[model samples]
Target: MTGAEAVGSGNLVMGRCVIAGKSACVLYDSKATHSFVSESYVQRLGLPVCELQCDLVVSTPASGLELEVILGMDWLSANRILIVCCEKSLLFPNSEEPELLSSHDVMKELQNGAQCFLIFTHLVVEGEGMICVIPVVQEFEDVK
Candidate 1:
């Protein structure tokens, strides 16, 4: 199946939310089991974005010591939830493979402080790929 089809199947299976605005289309991949936002759409938003195939496996903190994560529109949709608390760590259950993680984990991590230095190591690309970094908060009050 194609990427879009896989996304559709994943949504059907997981019952995740879909966020499609005039500028973007995002969905959760229940099968490949990763959240994704259309690269093309994100580009239109005037942000420098890059994508490596799921199999490509490009990661930050090549040392495997620093916490790493992949974030995009689809991830935001299912995880639009938020938790306002102090002291927490982000759990990446899907970090190993292609499984959806609980939004609760996202909320806790964001609230507790996830600002750590990141170094992306990509075999195919020259040097480490460091994109723009932005701090995010998942407020439960705004997830309608």
Candidate 2:
């Protein structure tokens, strides 16, 4: 069902995707630049893996996982399947309409000006270049 029909449910996009002749539930997350597959899922494919040195790094969980296939930026770029989605249904962007930026993209204009590092963040600037910087850290040693 589309988002219009499924409102109360979270903003997760669920769809059936055919990969290697297998249909699987594909969750679209714009924030996630990379894709991943569980070991159990790939194991079902029964494809022999080639032994190659890969610098691809994934954050280690508390417990080590024996198997996981991650589709990184390289994979996404190579497979040019554009996912156009909004609050409603997902589709491909037409010639007339342009695709909006993904959640991972920088949407707003950020101020690059250097603000003096003070005790805390969000310091209010006073009139005419006046700032009172305070030390957040204190230097004191406790003897046991």
Candidate 3:
């Protein structure tokens, strides 16, 4: 399922993902209404983490000059997306991919008319769970 469907259905995405040779599934709960990652996950992913329960950052898109976004964990979680009436697909750029972006970067891309697929995520940080909007890269990939 797409991130929107998962969030609307009030479900969590749990499955095994092989990261750095460790078998771990990304367990994402959209109902939490907040997004966060375990310190371990953050460390493993090598993404900058904030100590505050909730935080926002504004970043410029690498591909554009006039966009910025309030990036949070929810915005960072998706992996792929389908747009254009599901006839077209887009991959969520990893840091190495040069297309993966922070919230601000995404906003810039949107403002510039570089459209493919998009999802908005809002994260509420509490307990030990994290909520995120996921992009569907493969048709059969599981979101819950």
Candidate 4:
């Protein structure tokens, strides 16, 4: 699904998975055509990325998604996995013995400081007007 759809649905299946021996937040998005990894997460983990032959464009209507990796249909199809949304589990039909990966609600995990906050502002421009925008970050302590 598009980032906008995922945000609107609010029923995203999220879980913790180990990548390269490091734990990371993983999103199982069935509607997404291809998988993606957050640039910040990759850089932080020093993971190697190979150049793709073709360019891919991603549109996140509302930015600041805190997910570390998104497992899209590409990965799911390759593994012949079935997503049991109601049970919040993944069924691996291709495995010699069917295996299931169950996931718990991620709200508790996110509460432990893995949250991302987005700030939005409105800008007005007149006819044929040009505007320059800069981003500033401020840190605050004891913000409830």
Candidate 5:
């Protein structure tokens, strides 16, 4: 998308969400099994921190990180919702690989803090493979 277009409609799944009475830009990841809040933001807002049963080491371009307050399975179950995913209404929100993660249950495991990081995943461009993880939070307006 062009810079102007991105500034205009924004991208898929980007929307306004209220976290701890503050306006937070939230992105809905259909693949993400957990919802995460920024640790620093949490600290700033003084949100309650709860101990997890285990640590959550996440894979990212920066190697790895262990989080503290991951709003995972419980959060998703609590917020059973389907807000906005993509801009186009013609496109279906559900994935074509419905059975892929049906019984999979957990798609990601994070101990607690999921402030934000980049993970390198494979993408095909004209039959050629590319390694990239676009940091949309930095690109979008007021995503903190």
Candidate 6:
């Protein structure tokens, strides 16, 4: 499934997961044929990429998406993971002790970041004078 379709679908589940020891928002999309990670995210995290034997193209909306990763059916079935949509959770049957990953509205967590970027972009586009962004975390002051 396309990212746009997944975002609009009721079957899609949003949750948090750790990737390379960093927190990341993930979308569990049952309709997607294969799992995918954002190219920009991969570059930022310095994750290795393996070229596919055949070409694969993905089409997504031009804007309004901030997805970092998408876990599709291929990964779910291979990992023996079950999606309990009614309860909004994922069950991992392969684990020594069954593990559950509860789903949450990751959008709520990302709203601040999205808003910040959107405002910054708008100001830049409208030439609304010099803009300064002071991040709460000093370490991330240079992030943008």
* Highest lDDT scorer: 4
Query: Please, what are the lDDT tens digits per residue for candidate 6 over residues 1-144?
Result: 655665686555778889887677787878788888888879879988888899878754314567788888899899888899897789766447633322333355465452211222343435666667755554645546
Candidates ranked, most accurate by TM-score first: 6, 4, 5, 2, 3, 1
If scored against the real structure, what TM-score would every candidate get? 0.24, 0.37, 0.25, 0.53, 0.38, 0.54
lDDT of 2: 0.50
The weakest ten consecutive residues by lDDT in model 5 span 60-69
Each candidate: RMSD: 21.8, 14.4, 21.9, 21.7, 18.9, 21.5
Q: Score candidate 3 by lDDT.
A: 0.46
Per-residue C-alpha lDDT of model 3 across residues 8-31, encoded as one tens digit per residue: 553333444466565553543333
lDDT of 4 by residue, 17-100 (tens): 898887887888888898888888799789899898998787642254568888999999998888988977787663476333
Q: List the residue pairs that clash in candidate 6.
A: none
- State, as a TM-score between 0 and 1, how close model 1 is to the true structure: 0.24
Better of 1 and 6 by TM-score: 6
User: What's model 1's lDDT at 133?
Assistant: 55
Please report, in order, the local distance difference test score of every candidate based on alpha carbons: 0.39, 0.50, 0.46, 0.73, 0.47, 0.70
Alpha carbon lDDT of residue 59, candidate 6?
58
Task: Indicate whether candidate 3 or candidate 4 has the larger TM-score.
Answer: 4
Candidate 5's residue-wise lDDT over 36-74, tens digit each? 776766886787999899999753111122222334444
As for model 3, its CA RMSD to the true structure in angstroms is 21.9
**Candidate 3: worst 10 consecutive residues by lDDT?**
60-69
The candidates, ranked best first by lDDT, are 4, 6, 2, 5, 3, 1
In terms of TM-score, the best-performing candidate is 6
**Per-residue accuracy of model 2 over 1-144 as CA lDDT, tens digit each:** 543433335554556666787766555444456776766667777766664486776442213323234444444455544544565334443356534443334233123342222233476887799677777657768868
